[model samples]
Target: MTVADVQLFVTSAVGGAMVGETVEGIARYPINLRYPQSWRDSPQALRQLPILTPMKQQITLADVADVKVSTGPSMLKTENARPTSWIYIDARDRDMVSVVHDLQKAIAEKVQLKPGTSVAFSGQFELLERANHKLKLMVPMTLMIIFVLLYLAFRRVGEALLIISSVPFALVGGIWLLWWMGFHLSVATGTGFIALAGVAAEFGVVMLMYLRHAIEAEPSLNNPQTFSEQKLDEALYHGRGPARAPESDDGGGDYRWSAADSVWNGSRFRGDEPDCRADDWRHDHRAFAIAVYYPGGI
Candidate 1:
């Protein structure tokens, strides 16, 4: 691990769990070969052997020697790589330190060189990680609050949940759009995402609110019409079985009558039918109308 140590960092990687974040395979070749001092003077002489330098320049190893590369006939004839060979020499005396230094330089020269080793995770990384966790947690909780708000505001659980679920696509789109704009999501972007969640829900909420009403408003022969209590009882009984004359309008003139076989619903002001008492019609019609129109007290 000192200046006298010659290491060959071997260098390719396929894939692994951390494959995307890390240099595929962390590799290094360490050797202790030393050469005659004569080869240091001439670039041609240096290039003559299996030495591979990133740039072909004369190198001195008073305390450290440089790595060189050869991709010519001599190296090919030497049965190195098909047409190239990687070469390095050791500088004696505490060569480990020098070797590490030279290796650093070598890595700098190799384009797209992935790091071969790791010391430890950085504090910045940990900080960002904690931020990420908080953001993840906040996303769901914020969504939950929005859902609750929707429920309270709309007075219907189904429509509220639907609005909350719709926010994810908005979130995803915001993320992608930010990426397209080259905005690395930092603290500011995290805040923006929260805002986007609310905004996104509005998209669904606006539509959802209107949609529920539209659906509810659909004609229902089942839907009850309001009527005066006088005919209300009459309508209820006659509904069970028909044939009843319309009573005095109660002076209200609101005696529009629709009969369900079981009940007059809103009007049964007066009549002679079994169980067809006036009370039955008025009570059932009002109750049924209330149940249908604003059920859930909505």
Candidate 2:
């Protein structure tokens, strides 16, 4: 029999109802023509089904083609007009970047693809690559904006550059801490470094402001010709004195000039008065900067 005849008959007899009819005052009923289930239960039974050729010759279905069971994919899948297969992997106890890197190396060394075949990596690794690319551009732009703002605030290239320089120091400290904790660099950590740059710039500006005020308070140290190490130290010593004297029983207090007070409220010296001969301001400045910037005691 012809292929079309076989298909038409098989669809009508086995697939489903070929059509439906409606009767007045009655629901629609389907018109179907199928053999009893027992008559077509196995391949052997199917092979015995009768077929009428155009020449009016009677024959069995087995005379046309072989019939047997086989195995295949339940459904076909394709990508870009080509068949495709999917393999999923999950990483454990390792960073995504390193895991993907090792996977790529192993695939390249061992897995062989036939002609016209290609493999692509995606998912989180794809997102990471995109983020890293944007960060490369964003980080430099962020630094440039910060430098411009610093220059506008201080109105001096030297002072702006000085504040901008502190960002690298803060970044180094952040990187060191990450390394110590065995953490990988990611979008979250990069964002944190951006925040760190802002904080470092703020601290640098405050420190610079206090140092300038200290120099301006002393005439001899203000001038470049008479500015000496000893005179500068004397200015810092007085500039970093307690912000306010101890309150008296009458609820009254005296205000004192203090650089550390700009950062820490109610900061005081070791005693009622600062010892000029000692280098206490240096220590206090370091301690205050550390305490303010790294409250966790880094």
Candidate 3:
């Protein structure tokens, strides 16, 4: 028989009779099985299926088409309505950005793409790029806000600028600490640096304010009486500072305390009296406050 005649006969009679036709929605939540499951469960069973019937003009599937069993991809993937496959490369002991950068460079140098095929570096690299873009805008905005707030607080452009300048110094220490701790600069690290900058700026402002107050309230050495209580208030902010001088370590009549002796033994009172250690004074909040406020002996 001719190829078309054989094809028509085999499709209609033998294979169709054995395999049966698939019907959808034949029953509610049920599959309609015209043939048993064992009919074509294996390649051997499929090959042994009857392709010819005795009563009809004889035809065989072998005469019409070539059918050879072989293995193929279990599943296919598509992206953007086009067939695609992923080749994943993982990073260990290296940064994702640098790895992706080197990959792009190498691919550009050595690899060639076909007409319909393409490649992309995604995952962490894509996320990092997005984060960097956001930070680019956020960093400048944060700095502007800090400058404006400092200017409002200090009421002087010079003081604001000076305080803001210390932010970088604070960031240097933070960056170094991060590096020492074996951490890469990420969003969290940037956030911590921002916090550090705020604290550094605050300290700068406080120091500048104290210096300005001291300079404004300086007393002349010519007349001791001219240093009134008002001048003392101006210097110490209305008795907020030390009320009494830190005593000397020496009781050698009018002898003075050495820096080392003061730090080691603390201040001494009268002869043969028990002394408070410098370490104790440091730990005691009241003693610390007294020492800081009164650098000179009363």
Candidate 4:
């Protein structure tokens, strides 16, 4: 008999019945017919299996084909057409960066690779590395753009720089909150900080606008010779023009006014306070206003 005939006979006998079915009530069940377990228990039993040829002659399977057990993979996996092995790690109660850092160090110290063998780390850590590289370029560009926009809006380098400087003070609370919550720095946190910076800059701009409008509305405060720290402080506290009316009900105006009062009170209540003039008081007022309003964005 041909190899195909032998293969078909052996497979049909051992692979169980394909066309048998049983009906019970309205349900149907498949039937698998094969040699009894005792008759097909080992390699020798399988080897002695009978096969029929077209000539009506019976021959044993061992006469045509070899049947023996051996060891090999049931399934093979490959990457880039090369066989690969995978190692999976799960980090718990710690940050992924630190875990991976320790893992890399351990591997470097303990594992050695043969020629043509190399190890590459991937997954979330890979994405983090890529994001970090992008942020290095993106963050400074973002700050520069914000500064440029602030400069465009105010047309003054000092004011733009002032707003930019306020961003760090804005971020301090968020950084502390993250620390309290046991959060590690990541891409998500970096993006949040960028957004916070923008908001801080906006608050600074609003505070500057309020101060400028208050000074402009009172012609006396604009004149250098007439300007005094006490007069400026009074003007800042009670400066309610058309610009202040709409913001009063919105909570922002009250916050800004209260912030100004806090700075004035801080300076007025201090026994060892220096005799700072109007410029220093104005600077302190601006800084205090920014500190108070910055949290509103969060």
Candidate 5:
């Protein structure tokens, strides 16, 4: 900003859309930096000489917001430039609309109202701050809803706790990954957090579902007619137990199928359990095989 002879330093294509290299080459034809050019009829090739290096990083629409133009604003304030002639005020801290309003006032009141080019801007801090606050409120409520869902899906409180606790850990890992990749936490980052939450709970849901299926099949546990300790430890912590546990019916001599071993195989859950003369409920392998491992178990 030049006050006396300050012709207000202006770069035509600094942030404008019309600043293309091809267009500039065409506009500045017969271009010579150090040497005189003998203009030929053919289009002039730009003479190579090092001048000022420009910043070439691209800024996307997602990274910017709030661009406004006002009717009232000043370009140059005084007729003759003085020490106090140049005014660069951060009027945004006040009534934001007034920032532009003040600029408009300057132009209307100033002597040099015929100034050529002035300022260009994109994005606003206040608007971004407000939007971010709204999302912060939304994030916690969403996390709470997920916690309720986990609690309802798994009857035990401990199971829900385990799943919910992992939420922060997973998010931290994701943030670290994105940060290392040169990405900042922005509006898209909120979406990423939501995606991670669902994925983390998916594993917890599958584990709980498998445990439920095994519990319903065990006859020796808490069945329609029996209450025994045969499946006490296995049901408490499933899939991690011993391979060949005592089958519930024949007092430590009966063989049984493990659900976890054959979950993907489809052979363990063959068919409905068969009943005996005594009406004792048991995991019948004959029925199990036909039902679980039927024709081409998919």
Candidate 6:
């Protein structure tokens, strides 16, 4: 017999058997097996079974078929309707970035994928990468908005640029505090930094306004008001702008703006030298330090 004839005969004998008898539907009842055709149950027994082909010849099932024991996957997984395998990492002491980096390096060095095969990273690493990409687009936009608003408020490019420069200083404290609290460089941390930068710009604007108001409220620049450093200090102490001085838990005020002494003393309204420059250096340096130091207190 041919392979096809033998295959069909063996398939009918082994798999196509059906012995039927009536059983209980709702109430219990006895049912007897009408035809118990259990001869083709085992593979080893089926090998000895004889098959009658179309050529009127009898042959054993083993003449056409090869049967053996083997092992295969018990379960399979898929992604997007295509077969896939997953590798998971459980990080305890290691950071996600370094782990993912090392894994990718190892994969590139040791594993050779066939054509049409690909690999991708997901979970927290993927989320972080996406957040960083968004920050790359959003951070510059945020800074530009701050710059434009500062320029509009101050009506001077130099002043706006100065205030904007304080932004990085404002973020330092937030970043340090987040790290101390076991927070990584995430989207939430980045958002906090952006908000803090705005606050820094607000501080700069308020300080500038204080100086402007004090100068405007003083006697005219051409009139030349005579005042010593002590009087100028008093003016700065009392003539602060709309922003109230930050008070400690003990109700004392912080003297962060005390560096304004040189600025008040060297003002044109105070009738100092036209060439005299205020301690601009002191303002930026102190503001940066304050910005970096204050968030922890909050």
* Candidate lDDT values, in order: 0.43, 0.61, 0.53, 0.67, 0.42, 0.58
lDDT of 4: 0.67
- What is the per-residue lDDT of model 5 for residues 62-103, given as tens digits with 9 covering 90 to 100? 222222345754554543343224444553225333465566
> Largest lDDT belongs to which candidate?
4
Q: Report the C-alpha lDDT of model 4 over 1-298, residue by residue, as the tens digit.
A: 8888877776668777677888999999998877677656889999888777788888888999999999987778687887877678788777678899998898899999888777777888899899999999988998999999999999989778877877777666556555655656777667756765675576677666766676677777778988787776665665423333443333344345545654777867332222112222233333455645433321
Q: Choose the strongest candidate by TM-score.
A: 4
| Local accuracy of candidate 3 as per-residue lDDT tens digits, 107-183 | 88999999887888777789888888998898788889989999999798877776666566445544544455454
Candidate 1, residue 297: Cα displacement in angstroms equals 24
What are the per-model numbers of colliding residue pairs? 39, 0, 0, 0, 13, 0
Per-residue lDDT of candidate 1, residues 1-298 (tens digit): 2333213311111111122332336964443334444643455454433423356543333224454665755534322233324344443433233455565576667745335522223244446667878998997899889888888888988767656655554455445444444434454556655765675455445444433444344444225774344443343333322111121222113222312321554344321221222222332332333222221221
Ranked by TM-score, the better of candidates 1 and 2 is: 2
TM-score, prediction 2: 0.59
TM-scores of the models, in the given order?
0.32, 0.59, 0.56, 0.62, 0.33, 0.55
Which segments of model 6 are wrong by more than 4 Å?
1-75, 78-82, 110-116, 220-233, 239-242, 245-298
Regions of model 5 farther than 4 Å from truth = 1-124, 212-298
Report the candidate with higher lDDT, 5 versus 6.
6
Q: lDDT tens string, model 6, 110-129?
A: 99999979888889889878
Residue-wise lDDT of candidate 2 within 1-298, one digit each (tens)? 6788877656655555646565667666666657777657888987887777789888877888587989988778897899977777777756688898998899899999889998877788888889999999998999899999999998999778876765665456556545555556766667656755675566566556655687788898767898898887766655444211111111121112232333354334322122211112322333344323321111
- Residue 273, candidate 1: Cα error in Å is 79
Query: What lDDT is obtained when candidate 2 is compared to the true structure?
Result: 0.61
